[model samples]
Target: MPKTAALCISVLGTGNIGSTFAFQLARTGQHDVTVIARPGSTRLQQLQRDNGITNHRGEHAELRVAASLDEQQPYDVVIVTVLAHQVAAVLPALQRSAAKCVLFMFNTFDPEQLQAAVGEERCAFGMPFVQAHVNEAGTLKATIGAGGQKSRLSQQRWVAMFKAAGLPAVFEPDMPLWLRCHSPLCVAFESASVLAVRRGGGASWQQAMRIARGVHECFVLIQGLGYRPYPSSKKWLAASPAWVLAFVLWLLSKNFTFRELLAGGVAECHALIGVMIAAALQTSVPVNVAAIQAMNPTA
Candidate 1:
């Protein structure tokens, strides 16, 4: 952990996921992690006062603070952990940044647009399977992934880097297709959780089955667009019995922690479903748009 040997990393966005990454990286003492919190915001001020980030476990991580990305600053890697909707706003700055690589870590369906903005060579895509949420107490509550799952990244170099930093990550060669395939499931579960939250607990049998149908139809829509369900899990999900998926979703909805993890995902769900719906119009395959819309949580 020599100062000269440490990687100079910058993370944009100080929300739950961003804070979690900054904390984890700084805690290793192997990276000089600096995170961007909005200038003049309470969040940035609080971090400055605390001198670091504190997780729910009461662990503290001392990291450098920044009001915004300094395009001239020399950074080894700049990590973007913002939501899908917020990414576009930061694209210009990220494009001009001196960082060698910009890792866009989040769920994104149209990664080509991002790559184009920053030059394909400078962009790295990843799907963070990390589950995280910030509570009213202002401490991040997070997990890399429950049940031994690792965050999936497109670059093998990033996979190895994250592993060395004490964060489990697996290299995925085809992240775009993997993310596209994952959309139906992501939207389904988030919508289901939103509905379940409104209904007290768990999606009803009818709603669960409806969500299952959306998954099946959405996968078909993906195929109609000429993309095979990229990963085998998605292939199986589309090909498997609807009742089985319904049962599993229903069971998970009843799990308090599982539902809570997705409860705050309304906006992300909306953006994802919007993409799916728009893509649906391009194909003749029929998607139960009304059903999917009903399952979707409005902004």
Candidate 2:
């Protein structure tokens, strides 16, 4: 669809990611945007009370709000912004919905199973590079495509839609493999961030070394499974020397904004590690399970 044409969109999950997408899409005033929040969530109450989604500036995007998916209603697309762990619970609803397309925008090492359930033809994947949050008082604070960053979307139509909504997105040829390859580093970064938060935001060279080791093991395990760590940036992360990667991670670890974006990502870290180990069992991959497991958040 052209960027100017209107389409009915349902954004499931109303946390930072959901609200960010909803606010931007609604602001375009071309698409019909409806954001779904949990029935008892404070986010739902705020959306209803304000009767719209707001950016950090207190400006409103006059969008529709809902607490659940209307499976019977035919929507042009349903963009899921929830975490991978949360996807299972919403799968049944999505499976029953009449939406023409389902675009999942989140981190996941394994998306094939999701696509199997969602149906391959209509299923789409996206990796969000935006830094966003719904802060207190129900305001959205977000940064999109800063420093030439671009989110990767598997499908072209959705890419156009995100760009049209003022959210930067680029098309990826093999999103599933890209996500799989990206998972290892994502877990390392998130786990380190969890530990850093516990340390009161201090960067630890020691922690960086351990996380770097975990990343290397993760790369090895996935590569043994015949997955190419595509995208030049991820390729470098996978093939670089351990000490070099550690230094880079240590540098990023000191940035408050970087750590903040990775905060509360412990659940995702744990899940990705588990999936990695599970996938490794099918191959002769020598994964340093102990070293990788050390990155899990205890707190």
Candidate 3:
């Protein structure tokens, strides 16, 4: 008989990231995917009825949904995709379960707190590198992660699974540092896009340039912190001067879709920038403090 191992996965959030992930796994026809949403969430009920999920340029067929952590046991891996606050509650619940692997597929720069809560043996971090959203109609799209970095051996299996599922992914040794460098640009550009929208600024090719500049600033900061900068679509940032970064932002403001898709989404960009600022404050690294400070809404 062939050696058989059961791989069970439960995602702790049912919004865009969670639902989309569930769909991704289900499409693989491998791991048994269960989405744990708040009890009696209408959206969960609707998803259960639809039994389907849509991704960028493709649609995943029907899959099952689970509404509680108590419904399953001995989960092989527990993927948490909830908001920052929701993580606190979910952590204790996981402590009550028999999950052997717990991976956070979203923002987790603060490793100490997470390791303390979930135990390092079961803890891992994943940064999905794509702009995605779950509209009111329950459609999903944009499932991608860092194409530039690779995770440590400790995380290769899960990374391999994601790659096999056709999602762009990589497992990095220094996940925190990678997130630190990756998230700042994402946050700054999106937040700036939101600001631009309010000013009747549309997203254009020019706007893409601005977003690229913000990413460059983050790259500079990461290099200052002694980490390799990850690759992004912001090629202009690599070839141009800092002033050119500012100029690109001016151009991007004319494109409506960029503003609507990125700037108009959740406050992830703000949170990312906040994490970078906190890290800088803690380290006393003043690489782009003035530029970062100027971008601060309250500053």
Summed backbone clashes in each candidate are: 0, 0, 23
lDDT of 2 by residue, 33-134 (tens): 999998898989999998888787777898888999999989999999989988888999999999999999888888998898889988999988888888
Cα lDDT tens digits for candidate 3, 1-299 = 12123367788888866776677677763567777777788778767777756655666656656677853487888888885535777777877778888887766445557777778888788865555677676777653554453223238777677766655565677665555555655565566577678767653444444455556656666666666654443334545675565565655655776667666434555555666666666564556655554553223
| Candidate 1 residue pairs that clash | none
Q: State every prediction's TM-score relative to the real structure.
A: 0.91, 0.95, 0.72
Query: Which stretches of model 3 miss by more than 4 angstroms?
Result: 1-6, 51-62, 130-133, 141-154, 203-241, 251-253, 284-293, 296-299
Model 2 CA lDDT for position 25 = 85
Candidate number that wins on lDDT, 1 or 2: 2
- Candidate 1 has its poorest 10 consecutive residues by lDDT at 290-299
Who wins the TM-score comparison?
2
Measured by TM-score, how close is model 2 to the native structure? 0.95
Full-model lDDT for every candidate: 0.82, 0.84, 0.63
Q: Best candidate, lDDT-wise?
A: 2
Quote model 1's TM-score.
0.91
